[model samples]
Target: MLNTGQNLRPGSQLFSSVSESNHAKGKYYLGNQQDGNLVIYPAGTIDADSSYWSTGTSNRGLLLTLSLDPNGTLWMFDGNTSFTKTLFLTNQSSGAAPAVENYYCLTLDADGVLRLYSHVFLRLEGKPTIKVAWQVPGDRCLVKGVCGPNSFCQLTMTGETSCSCLPGFEFLSTNQSTLGCWRTLPISGCVRSNNSSNEETRMMATMVEVKNTTWPENPYDALPVTTSIEDCKLLCLSDCACQISMFSDSYCSKQMVPIRYGRISGSNNTLFVKVYTYRAIQRKKIAGAGAMLISGATLVVLSLVVLSGSVFLICRHKRSLRYMRAPQLYDCKVDGDIGLQSYSFQDLDVATNGFTQELGRGAYGTVFKGVLANISKEIAVKRLEKMAEEGEREFHREVRAIARTHHRNLLHLLGFCKESMCHLLGYDYMPNGSLANILFNSDVRPSWSKRVAIALDVARGLHYLHEEIQNPIIHCDIKPENILIDRSGIAKIADFGLAKLLIGNQTNTLTGIRGTRGYLAPEWSKNTAITVKVDVYSYGIMLLEIISCKRSMELKRAGSEYNISEWAYECVMFGETKKVADDACIEEAELVRMLKVGIWCTQNMPVMRPAMKSVVMMMEGSKEVRQPPRPASFSQS
Candidate 1:
């Protein structure tokens, strides 16, 4: 029953009878009082009454003429050239044809009744039906002008307004113009409440729950429900500089700085302390009393074990250290002098759960999935299958080399484990498996753009290793199996066991062949001096594979040989480059650009090959492509 100005439309009629209470009728005008003009209707008699005239020509439609009575009877001047009305059951305008007009006026009375008036015609029948509705003009806010306390205002469709607190706050008052809200005090300054005793305050403060809050910056700082108040308090108390403690039944969070925008839920029952006294003596007394009896017996046993083990371990370690520290007599047995953090065998065993989950098997060792116990972070554990001399040398070399290097595109070494017959190296796990899985698997084929991205990622990673680093490293074994993909479809180079670090312009003196077949540089086959170009050639082949989405080698017949790189070379020379491209990458300009780079990298002469730096630049830079020259035996097949 609110008198909202709604549901009123122009061109409506209202009627009243003579029997209506306190009816006063002679001549009454039905028009807006706010306007000076009024239309008169005669109510008492049908005559040319001068009292109804208000200084206007009658022919121009009397501005104040009235000829209707409250008895539902009509009255008007009856003449040939004058306005006239006849008594009828209904009060209807009867006169010369009226001109069509658009203007109308409507008004509401004290009782919320609407009355309408139109210039063209006025008609009223028996008990005219009337309906009312409501409407809003524009948006409104709960706060008159400004927003809530320390809050901003927003308008609703119906013109209603509301408030929102700024960053690092909760709504403290409905009247937002005054004080807004307070932040939880820091743990270093936690104090007992002055309002009431701890017990009474805990009950009241717990009940005064903050409701419907959100942390604008770090949501993790929101108190979780899994942890207890005591546990939450202990966590906050342990960190002397903590600023806030949020706890739920399931979790607890402590912040070291001012808590940001967080809504207090209605159900929160945790206490927020500003600071508390450090009772170290009481804590020490409790700990000392509990451990006194057990400490003696445990210490006695531990001493005897330590005394015996220490002597034996000292001698064994001294011998092993001497052997490892000795000068290397062969190039293959090169010892990397990189100092890395060593992990205890027990630490790694606990991480991998005794190497239970086998991730993959390789010639050197079986890779297993492990978790770092201290951080609770997952990692890949490659446990080397102990062989005579080569495997042990490679294991030590890989750990030392990889641990010394750090790059975004390179896999990270989390830690390592060395046992009598098994050596394990922990690395960050790649969830999406390897590039081989993505390329060859029938279940999922990477889109052309994704393949181009993968190729660029791999190329950039190799370029970093080969050129960007102060001491460039050569990834001796670059192949599809070693190229791992992360969950986001990013490619990273792995398997640094055969990798060698180049200090200055020193070339890696290879004593034996070390690389995958079909991917080995042509110079490596001819016993040419190995350099970073070998890795570049291998990377080029891999790039071609990524662009083509095909294996380096495929069977043409039972006894025939077909190599993808060779076929691609033929296709390029014969001007049928599209035919050699991966069927999946067809019509993709990026793939074509990558293919051009790949061909340039795989040129027969090592010196003619672009440096990995140039390769990366060409892949990323928007430069024009150049036509490559046809080599001898371009289509040997």
Candidate 2:
């Protein structure tokens, strides 16, 4: 009968069929279940057969069958070598009627290639029965290599491996371990020989080869380059005692003193020169002729003087009048109700042991350590270098200025020695040497508190000089080496050679460039006018060095782009304030506070920087800190 919506088939092999009838829905009936093709009415229905069947449940709706290989094995559905079933399959299949199964499951391999197998057949055995074989893609290959010294290599299987040098190199630091090697050494430019044979022979050939590798160890003794190499050689050879000459492309440098560390690298470029034979002979001839002329002239002048005594006396009187009317080289004034006492040259000579003991040597003169036997005390004897005009003026200025000044921080002058051309000033002895020695030595590092104390001491000394002293003294050159520390670690400012007294209300002095290179104030470079602010700038640099445990010049290398001050400035700007503290300092808060004061003193603009008086207060934690302006040129290089 044909129903509204129904279609069915009887038997597993299509033995009965049903179609829709005009009045009733189609129905399906089966005579018996057998192993044959079968269909059910409606799209969703159940079918059964003697050997195989399928349920219409939503979960397991679709099922399939498989035939075994022709190896005397009965036909059975393949279920093994398929899905990896553990407890569920083992327990459920064992209790229930033998589970109807079909084709095996497939899985992805390590290379992501799919593999199919027979689950029922493979599970009956101990191990998997199927095997998979496929080629691995070329992109999946691995790479291995080694990096060479000063060269870094990275492995990349997708492309070629790469090798490169570290920063600050024109090429790879070392030759490649594999292919593509390159040289790292910079190509030597043109090798132009020095024009003067004497200079080349003395500096390049003789002195540099003979002396120790390192030269000019003392920072104070560094020579400045002047004229050409030939001129340099002539200058050195002209002076019989000249020891070394430093030559550059433009000028030749000659040192009439000791070469501290003699080593020179190609990068140094400067030449070291020594005296040659020909120049020595010339100098001797010149000195002989000059001496003979002086002797003959003195004898003739004495004979003329004896013949005309009255006439000579009248001429001498007139000469004296003329000399008295001439302007003095320097003006002098005394303070503190103390009268100036001048001793003869003979008196100082005996007191200083004939100037046998040299306490220190400077650009101006030698300071001899002396003991006044008559006075029963030790004193520093400063013998000024000979001067025709300017030097004498400076000597007199130094004597008058330092003589009247009396402060705990200032070095004390006892007396003075004056003669026709010789001058000497006496001072109290400082047992411990300058601050430079203690700060740079590797053997010991001063405690954090001690460094801060030294800074405060220096500031106080400057404050007194700028404010309390009758004639305000400006310490034009204020470096660590100029600061002397006594046995008790109390710092006293010394070396008043470059000091000048303030005239009237003048805040600045017009003078030639003086003081160390790294410590000079920026204003000094542009204008001749100098103020106490120059010393303040130098003190700032010194304070930064003390806190960071580094030298300003040493920080200019392949690394350390930022100098001690710049580095501290960066830390402050980035809000990483703790980085300013030195590793040796145990007190974090104190170190930061000191660094803040240092930055304030080092501000580029003179108007922005605080005076020594304000700096002292800030160090004592009595003042608040404002943001310091950026430095003009912070580069150490």
Candidate 3:
């Protein structure tokens, strides 16, 4: 009886009291509880308590059922429904009502008891929890046909039970009075009708009318009929599907099922049982119409499938043409004297084995482990993200620089693919991945000397980008993800997709927010014109994060207690930098000096930070260093 809440759905359950589908028309549902209660409620959210109905029978063996009729009425019954309770679900101040468009379910237990539950998606527990709305006890008096047939139960003045037949009816079973009574005139000629006239058929139809009674029972069709009582009776007679018609409160319900009722002397309702001699003939006609409808629907579904398939093929062909044309814009067939080469999509697909063996995914696209056929060299293939004109300009800038720029401390771009809209870039594979992963994820920790060497190499690469080139290039994104390590554990700067080429004295690059969170420079937040100093600030943050093995972004503001940077600065000020150097195995003086230099680079004002050349000099111990003042960002605190 204990089930995960996710299994609850609209019109789904273990056992329903009625053999027919409950909540088939949607909106209403039922759930069987472990406590043996049968409940009926709306689906999707936790019980809104809008207007739910239930058979309040719990912990009573394993029999339960919660059912709903097409017309807003819900029933709670079990295998033994003689004493089961009935509830009408309508919107009111004192009841629960269902919301529109939600998943719901009803369950009947082995004991024949019924309960209703709604499906609620609450993820803190990582599964749904069932909310009970309504339940019904398997009260035996409520079971349909308990009094058997054509007979009603009566309580005598002495509190005894007795069964009696209607005026002209007789008992079907003499020994068992509850087995019900039958009509004095047997229903015949129903199967022998040979297309009789409407007048003759209506004349032969006999109505057994009983007032002050209605059964909370099964239905063949529960819908609005004419206000006139006689019209309601005639409507039931016309439809062969309907055997009995009940009218109460201005609505009519026609049913083919047996009617069961509790003894009531003053209900003021009407229940009519129509006996037609041609009922068997009408049933055959209905069955034939159903077969023809199914055949017509099948043909319509097949035609729609063919039409949709043709449209899909045409759209795919048009898409392929756009992809093929995108690569022709650049002359990719030409080879150059530059170190980098050009590749086609077909050539890369073979290299990466159809883009299999995925290394990982990034913010843009996927990276795969690949191998070149000509050189037989293992490489990393990056499928560049599709972009607009501005991004296309950036892609071209990266390609041109990779072709010309060559440095031992920089990652080598082997080639690029431009055969279609699929853009890819290939780079020499690094045995050791990024510094962040090496420091945080891997078992082999980077030694203090190795950390210092890595820092110097990264600075040299930045120095090459800032001062070495004729027109300096700004590597706007310089987080550890872009720092690749060679087989010898040498750090190399990579991922130049965010590189901006500077011409002459132009340092201002106006654009939207760029770089990742926790690593973005302060200038990005201000929307101010960016300079190489932005890279300096980012490098400073990266350097501090490397030293203490702590995150700079997680640090407190300058005056709000200790962040990694602030802690390192204060430690160095007190001649205790070695304490914050973590488990590094390096000379105390070098650790002290690196800590000082790291803190100085992260100063609030970009102008206060040193250039890449000065950073390299400070790490190499070739230049004099000065103690820094409290950072300007502290003023806010």
Candidate 4:
């Protein structure tokens, strides 16, 4: 008996002979076959071609049942309610529920489709029309056996499915191409015949290459590895039983005749079809010998033109190479901030050798050490790993901000790459490492004068970014990790991944909290507008670390002394400034002066913080260092 408009709960079984019809008396109905495939077939028929939709879950398990839950999701599961494993599911389509309580069913209509429908009971004295809620294998071509063996299926521009015969095969029926295809010539076994040897048979056959196509059939033999596509093709041609072969990523698979489930693909798979050498030659002969003669002349003319152009380009490139070989010209190109180089992702990937040497990781990506063989210059490549749209904007902004500025203290942007989904920035490599290593981890810290000079270097870089440029920029993240030391021990500011640019004459902008904690300005947490002063606060904390060689907020340091700025201020109050200086050859006067400048910069109020320009002067002793009030709310203790 067929039932309609009834919900199938968990453990409800539909046998091979059982079916549920649509409430509107449709000719088609839903049934679960004895082979364990849930299918939709028309009335009084079970032919394979007549059934266009199936769950494809044959041999799932014993005692399987199809259930449609209250949320409108239909699922097929094996076993009983207590121990069930879900095999397949379809998501709910419509948000509206059936007006009749607990009313829904899997229905098959005259259109030859299996669907889940909801009957909305009308308030008036009238019957309710059923709405199609969901259907599987929506396109007819997705149904298996639609296009039989030796043929491929594809969708036309009009969105209709079509079938085509594979190479070296002919359509079984022109009127109904879906009936599939047959090979034009039969192939013999691998056993050597009296007339031909195995090698001779291979020479008589040729492999035709087909790109962007695949057949999902399992291979009879698979080679673990092959050197190239040519090697895979040769192996397939050498085998008498192999009619089709697929090669991808060094792996080759050999398939027998009558390849099934053929379709055009966008993957990297390449299909090779074996055919007789005569047939292959016959196809090529369609172009004719006259066309080949013309093509030969055209190729000779084109080759000469290409050779002449290549000679001119080679000479021109050598001249440019000679000009750029000088250190001064190469440095000038980076320092002038004009005509920046645009590198391709492939070039950078080859330079970095697949980004094997990782230097460090940042918020968005990792930095790698690479050398450009063409220019013979070592560089650090920052490859952004975030492939989202937002990450692309940040990449472009960083490139734009650094490309427009030139300063000795600021890291130079040598080039950039924005290809496909890859984003990378190239800069001159710093062999001396970062300031964080020198301050906190190094065994031998630099002398007092050298440390002061390093502080001045960073201050000058920040000053140039905050005021010296036409459009003022804010280095939102300023910490020891960002300050890199060059071969000359000159500190250069790097990692502008978080830097923000202020529009024409705009000194401040509102933004969410950014920058490392313990270095962040008080205004950041208050949800107020941020300015260059935030960077000053961060630099102040880093400056104290530079002077004392202690982290700003060391959790390991006990007794209210973890915060370096707070502890330094207390030491200064007691006139024991020497206690704050960690270097054995500390210059007491310079330490006091630098510490005072640092204190002023870390003031709780952004208004009280000195600008980066003033900090540079104080570090160089051009401006007098005065007594700074206790850095109020800035304490990290």
How high is each candidate's TM-score? 0.44, 0.45, 0.46, 0.45
Which candidate number maximizes lDDT? Answer: 4
Q: Estimate the lDDT of model 2.
A: 0.51
Off by over 4 Å in 1: 1-341, 385-400, 500-506, 555-559, 573-575, 582-589, 631-637
Better of 1 and 3 by TM-score: 3
Candidate 1 lDDT over 516-570, as tens digits, reads 7767776665656777787877888788887777776662535666655556666
Error of 1 at 519 (Å): 0.8
Clash count, candidate 1: 45
Q: Relative to the true structure, how large is the alpha-carbon lDDT of every model?
A: 0.52, 0.51, 0.61, 0.69
Compared with the true structure, the alpha-carbon lDDT of candidate 3 equals 0.61
Instruction: Give lDDT tens digits, candidate 3, residues 562-619.
Output: 4456678778878787666657456787787787777777777564577776787778
Candidate 2, residue 361: how far the Cα is off, in Å: 2.9
lDDT, residue 84, model 2: 20
Over 307-416, each residue of candidate 4 has an lDDT whose tens digit, in order, gives 99999999997878866633223221232225478788888898899999999986557999999999889999988664444444444555666776666788888888
